[model samples]
Target: MKKITIIASLLALSATTFAQTWSVDKAHARLGYSIKHMTLSDSEGNFKAYDAKITATKPDFSDAKFDISIDVASLNTENDMRDKHLKSADFFDVEKYPTITFKSTSFKKVNGNQYKLVGDLTFHGVTKQVMLNAVYNGTQENPQSKKLVAGFTITGAFKRKDFGFATEAPATMLGEDVNLRASGEFVKE
Candidate 1:
């Protein structure tokens, strides 16, 4: 019994040692989106405020879990009038839904530096499962900060109407699909 207890304690210690927490380097990250407008051109925008974090036990981050939250009021399309309209009840309804959040359920390795990320996304007061293609851009030491950091890029698309956003807009006025692209560098904490 004494020998068994000793082995169990060592195992627990090893597991704890491998676990790591990574925090987003906000200045090195961005969350942006694009959607077709007027059935002609694509309108692009990005959120100015957001937070993201990752937790992993593997060196390759194959078992990483991600959590992210975006401030809806921080949305900007470079057009003041359009930005205001988007924040109103006609679109995002920022008063009712102040934020959008995502929590990863699975992060599966696909090929070299490629992964499939599945998660639950809560947007516009509705929650739904979403999948995104993730690319592990590798890890390296930041020259200035002298810290270990990991880089990643994630992309996906979902229907705006599915999230109860801009439901009244016609197809000719605004496309149903919203394309998302986010990239960030995370520093081990």
Candidate 2:
């Protein structure tokens, strides 16, 4: 009877593990980023097209995995002429490299509701691994839309020169670092 009880407990634990997997809707990813402008302000932009595959459960994300991609050509800054210039060879060079991608290498829980996400970021024909310190702003059941909603604020920085974005506009001001800040959300379908 003791041996039978042990087997039963093990089975119960296995069932709990099987129930922990969760899949978020790929269409619900909100991706945006900001870069310093003229060393005085920040210029914000977001890609309107992208995809994500996230597997995570509420409260505990140890088993979670995340993958994200952004279309370089879909970059929009709310100005038509400026947008076209940005898409040219001097900037993103979207014609040569069409997509920017991120594949997670590792993630670790920080303090409350936060995780340090380390991933590879590819842009402008360059691939560099970066870390996104993100805060998990809790998941909620939307009252109006009736879907699981999750939000995150990811703050990080990268040097513009690393990806061949060495614009002399900053050199005129004797500035070298191009800080970046990205924040967004994800929802369950």
Candidate 1 lDDT at 170 equals 94
Q: Give the Å error, residue 124, model 2.
A: 1.1
Candidates' C-alpha lDDT: 0.95, 0.70
List model 2 lDDT by residue over 31-133, tens digit each. Answer: 6666666667767777788776566544556545677778988888888897888798877778998998888787788888888988898878889988878
Best by TM-score: 1
> Distance (Å) between predicted and true CA of 71, model 2?
0.8
Candidate 1: lDDT of 168?
84
Clashes by residue pair, model 2: none
Q: Estimated TM-score per prediction? A: 0.93, 0.76
Best by lDDT: 1
